[model samples]
Target chain A: MGRVVVEVMPKPEILDPQGKAVVGALPRLGFTQFVGVRQGKRFELEVEGDVTPEILAAARQAAETMLSNPIIEDVVNVFEAEVSA
Target chain B: MGRVVVEVMPKPEILDPQGKAVVGALPRLGFTQFVGVRQGKRFELEVEGDVTPEILAAARQAAETMLSNPIIEDVVNVFEAEVSA
Candidate 1:
């Protein structure tokens, strides 16, 4: 088995209201150093196959095409790991 | 400087409409996976300070409290690295 992890986020130029809210809330949480916060999403998938480079590439393409919004968001990172038997 | 990367995802029990849609779209992209897709986010912050354990902890706490929705989502992973000068 293989595990794929993806992180998706709004493009830097786009306004992120959720990010803004979180940034506003930070002072209440005792973290006042950050000038801003940008919110995003993370996905972890378990592929029922060997962890091969091909599988990783396919999954990443799937992520880019279907899982993320190219107009407003981007896939920032992709990580894959072998599932130990 | 330091870099912080966070992955945020919805709780397993919660319904994920976006994930479902992506899962449905994958076959068209030639990925006939076993089943399902869950979407999430990633954040990379360039912290302006010394790269210390304390800074990392503070950033993590900030993520957990303000950035992530504890009621519906969880912070799955946190990674910190020193920014190369």
Candidate 2:
């Protein structure tokens, strides 16, 4: 099956509490190299056939409309993903 | 500054309610080309300098131990990301 990958991230100006929690937890876990952390969402949409341009456009529209809140998040990426199986 | 991208996804055998909900909602929204959906996580780790091998290793470690729950989730990808700014 063909798959499409869509990535969504909080806007740069938005405050991400989950990411802040992760940043706070990292130092305690002895991984202090990271200066910041931002948590986001990844989606995989499965298709029965090849990922056509129409499917990609539909996925992008779904990403912007259903998957993410445009005011708080940005659709950072939308692309066809190689399916291993 | 440099960034490292980490992706985590639920195990295939695991049930993903959010993904299922998306799949169910897709057809109602008039985009019915998709067969399935899986929701996961994306994390961006910021570093003060370049993403070195050591940082990559640390990110991998963090991904496995902290970012994802080994019981139901898998760390899918960990790589350096080019920073535009």
Best by DockQ: 2
**Backbone steric clashes in candidate 2, count:** 0
Summarize candidate 1's per-residue lDDT along A7-78 as a digit string, tens digits: 677888999988787667777878766665667777666677665787778778866886678999888767
Query: Candidates' DockQ values?
Result: 0.53, 0.92
- Runs of candidate 1 with Cα error greater than 4 angstroms are A82-85, B81-85
Which residue pairs overlap in candidate 1's backbone?
A: A40-B41, A41-B40, A41-B41, A42-B40, A42-B41
Q: lDDT (0-100) at residue A18 of candidate 2?
A: 91
TM-score for every candidate vs. truth? 0.79, 0.99
Query: Can you list the residue pairs that collide in candidate 2?
Result: none
- Model 1 CAPRI quality: medium
Local distance difference test values of all predictions, in order: 0.71, 0.96
Q: Over the full model, what C-alpha lDDT does candidate 1 score relative to the true structure?
A: 0.71
